[model samples]
Target: MTGVVSRAKGAPVELVEIVVPDPGPGEVVVDVAACGVCHTDLHYREGGINDEFPFLLGHEAAGTVAAVGEGVSTHAVGDRVVLNWRAVCGRCRACRRGEPQYCFATHNASRPMTLADGTPLSPALGIGAFAAKTLVAAGQATIIDTDALGGWWDPAVAGLLGCGVMAGLGAAVNTAPVRRGDTVAVIGCGGVGCAAIAGAVLAGARRVVAVDVDAGKLAWAQRLGASHTVDSSRLDEDGVVAAVQALTDGVGADVVIDAVGRPETWRQAFYARDLAGTVVLVGVPTPEMQLSVPLLDVFGRGGALKSSWYGDCLPERDFPALLELHTRGRLPLDAFVTERIALEEVEAAFATMARGDVLRSVVVLDGSGAGATS
Candidate 1:
């Protein structure tokens, strides 16, 4: 198998030929069909997550089952699936209490993937899909109905449903639950933010405000159904709050989502909502940065200030349901895909990701030229 390996922090991932072991008990080996370049993968490359070196850098993926480990009866060879990081451990406290998304002991492949020299590599988020093949716990490869789910969310767009899109869209629909007639705002116009805007529209928000530093992304947000847009780069931290609030008649939005994950954007989201509204933080913030808000505000604010983990998604329930919705033409999942590339070009894709050149540059693996190499 050829996998993209990040040898160290801030280092380029090298395309190295490696060996993948047969699936152990309760594991599955997937011949990755496609993967997407995500900011989280970039974060891993930059050592933003942890000191775990030699990280496998791709996770947003969809593929077909090449082999299945013993005792895994739910899937077999030829099952088309999308990979998920939130593989639940049934024995965890969260799972015992019926909140499996918060599973404390999510499992990955018990085996380790190694470099050509036999050095172990940590798979990014328990998924390493930027290659010809990858190993995962059977639970992570959730089945998606390719025949049923199509449209803006065609079978090809299923990659987004694995992570970024799931987190963004789930933030609005699952976590925030933007009700019909609710006024909403999303800070950050990236893939997740745009998905948030789309989810808000699907939830029937009366007015959707899209905020971003880039005018181009904001314009795309408008096309995704945001009723208004704000250029956050042109506005100060407080100015952003006021801008979002101004659109909602000074009451502020009913739900404000900070998708940028910076402290400043988070602060804006805190003050940009109505007094009793919700503030959903869906962005990935760095650990060195700490949040310090006025203690009075936490008390004065009556509504929830929530942080979503994978948009509180239950893959079995949400992935298929969202896929069906996409097939029905209700959700525009296809628009999220801006370009398609190959596995060898993942490094270039990362550079493009850093530049914000496209909404999502997917690495198509199912016989799209890249498959020949696979």
Candidate 2:
């Protein structure tokens, strides 16, 4: 099957033939329908994630189970499912403590997807779905009951819950655990930040403030549910804080989320919330990014300073519930899909995402192409 492969760091990804081995024990093969072009995939292509060359990119995906390996009972052929990277191992210490979301040992397919020439390829975040079909551990496949959802589900939109969308939503719904009638502020109104805004609304936050330097992204945030927006492009750190406070009636938000993951935005999130309010950092940062904040501020501010990994989500628990919300016309998951293109357009999609022209550029394989979408 043909899949997108980043053969070298900082090089353009190529559509090349790949070898998908038969599913090993406890593994499953999914016929991918749609996969989102995520920032993480670009990070891998640029060697920001690691020096793992020849990565099978694309993880945010939804598909139908094509086959199941021996001893796999949880998933069966033809099961409509969303693929998740974190396939929690039941024996992990976190799982034993009833915190499977933090499972120390996540499961991936034991066998590797390789190049046609027989070189093993490291899949981005494990369940690479840029191709027509990909292999994964059975646990990574979370079955979605579209039948129960009144058959109102779209693979293009549903696949988003597999990663970035889930992370942002989970950051507010789970990490900050936004309370009803609480004021919430999210710094960064990109895909993840906008999802955080949507999550805040879903959690019943009284006021949801969207902060971003990009006017287009701020517009996107308002559509998703941000009650107010702060144009941080022309503002300094203090100016941004004051804008948020003014919207909250001179009192800072109860919960502030730093979705930009930069040192500056993080600092803004710290000071933009009420003194005793919670701050959640859901954005990812590089290793060289160091933080410097006043020690007195930490002592004075008396709420949780937390970082959310994948929105602290348990796919098995969160995916289905969020999908149900979408089916019920509550969560506007479809708003996230700006456009859908064929697999060959994956490379161009990255460029579009970089320019902030779209929230998500999805690769829709309609069972046509070198590798079938089914």
Candidate 3:
């Protein structure tokens, strides 16, 4: 099969021939329909996550089950599904406590997807879907009812629920638990940040403030239901905080989400929330970044400072429900699909993403070579 591969650190990704083996026990092989080009894949290419070379990049995906291995009774051939990176292990301590989202022992396919020369390839986030077919643990495949959603529901849009979109939506809906009439502020208006804005709206937030350095992204956030927007590029941290407070009766927001994982943005989120309000950090920071805040303020301002990991989401419960919401026209999932390119165009997609022009550039792996809307 053909797939995208990152062969070296900071090197351009290549479309190469790969050998995907049949599923092993408790695993499944999926005929991938669509996969989103995400920052995580770029991270892998740049060796930000690890030194694991020859990575099979791309994770956010949706597809149909082509085959199932032994002990995989939950799914069968032809099941339309979204691919999740976290396949919770039932015996993990977190799972035992009924918090499978934090399950430490997530499972992946034991066997590796190799290159044509028999070199093992590391699948980014453990469920690489940049190819026509990929292998993953059966639990990673969350079945979605495409038929019920109307047969025309685009798979490219459905695939986004597997990663960034899910994380951002989960950050607001599950982590912060945005309440009715609450004032919420989301920092950064990328794919994740816009989703956070949408989540805040779905949670019935009376005021949703979107903050970002890019004017285009702020516009995207508005379309996603933000009541106001703050262009952080033109303001300092204090000014950004004040702008958020100005929108919310000078008390700050009830919940402030930092989707831009920088120290300054985090500080803005910390100070942009009212006393006893919640601050959720959904953005991922680099290892070298350090955070320093006043110890006295930590005790004085009594509120929760939480970090959301994949929005504390359980795919089984969230994917289908969110998809249902999209089908009903409540959640504007289609807005995220900015473009749909063939699998070979992933490298160029990265450039387009860096330009901050699109929310998501998905790879339509079904040989369509057309945008999702087309």
Q: Report lDDT per candidate.
A: 0.87, 0.92, 0.92
TM-score to native of every candidate shown: 0.95, 0.97, 0.98
What are the per-residue Cα lDDT tens digits for candidate 2 across 1-374? Answer: 89999999888899999999999999999999889999999999999999978999999998899999999989889999999999999897999999999999997999999999999999999988999999999999999887878776578888999999999999999999999999999999889999999999999999999999999999999999999999998999999999998998698999999999999999899988997999999999998999999999999988889999999999989999998898777899989999889989988999999999999998888632223122
Candidate 2 Cα deviation (angstroms), residue 137: 0.6
Expressed as tens digits, the lDDT of each residue in 13-131 for candidate 3 is 99999999999999999999999999999999999999989999999998889999999999999998899999999998999999999999998999899999999999999988999
Q: Which candidate should be chosen as best, given lDDT against the real structure?
A: 3
| Comparison by lDDT, 1 against 3, better one | 3
Report the C-alpha lDDT of model 1 over 30-70, residue by residue, as the tens digit: 98878888988988899888879988778988888999999
Clashing pairs in 2: none
Clashes of each: 2, 0, 0
- State how far residue 148 of model 3 sits from its true place (Å): 3.2
